[model samples]
Target: MEIHGPGGISGPDRPELKPTEAQRPDKAASTDKVADEVNISEQAQLLEKLSQVPAVRMEKVEEIKRLIEAGEYETSERIEGAARKLLEEL
Candidate 1:
């Protein structure tokens, strides 16, 4: 189908085709299956409780600093694989 724009050019634009199959994890999907995850008071209480704990263990902090200085880390390689799969689905 030709969909003319203000520029007056036309091209094929079909909507019947499926989405590109990129798995967008919609956050709202959970709403239908579960009650509200947290109430304001409960959330405040939880936040207050969490605030009482030490932010991070000293040993963990040191390990993280050491890793950062030494450049020791890892990255997931699954993104490319997932993209390939989604393209295939499309």
Candidate 2:
């Protein structure tokens, strides 16, 4: 079957039958390929480093626990200061 285009220009009279590589212009390689490259941003590296740190400091936790056991952990001023700081963070 003949395929018609603009201005009545006809396509190939017959489809290719075992056309060689050089005879087939449409078969030419048109795209270029390169090796994939990946880059890590500075922020990502910093986040990764931060993730490696422990969420809670065991030494500080133990010290606070000891103070509570000694009946020295509940000063009103200290509690007010902590509450203020927490509100400020929010």
Candidate 3:
């Protein structure tokens, strides 16, 4: 029993088969790498902006501190007010 492939691709004459590295990457590995980069850049930019706006978080901090100092902090009231205002603005 002898085998002969067309165009001279006979037994032992063909090159050894090799898997290519350019094939589709491992989906989970690629997604994790991209997600890591995105998280790093997002946190970096957020910190930079927060640093530049010295008064941004300060205003919020002052409001909270004042409430805490005066014992006027009401969680439900603030939440409701903020939710209502947000809805109105939207």
Q: Of the candidates shown, which would achieve the greatest TM-score relative to the real structure?
A: 2
Candidate 2 segments exceeding 4 Å error? 1-36, 41-43
Model 3, global lDDT: 0.76
Candidate achieving higher lDDT, 1 or 2? 2
**What digit string (tens of lDDT, one per residue) describes model 2 on residues 1-90?**
544666353565544559687787774466775779999999999999999999999999999999999999999988999999999999
lDDT pick, better of 1 and 3: 3
lDDT of 1 by residue, 1-90 (tens): 454667454455443545554765665666456556845798899999999999879999898788778866333545577778999999
Clashes of each: 0, 0, 0
How much does candidate 2 score in TM-score?
A: 0.49
**lDDT, each prediction:** 0.70, 0.85, 0.76
Q: Which stretches of candidate 3 lie over 4 Å from their true place?
A: 1-52, 75-77, 86-90
All-Cα superposition RMSD per candidate: 27.8, 12.4, 15.3
Show pairs that collide, candidate 3. none
lDDT of 1 at 33: 66
User: Rank order by TM-score, top first?
Assistant: 2, 1, 3
TM-score of model 3 (CA atoms): 0.26
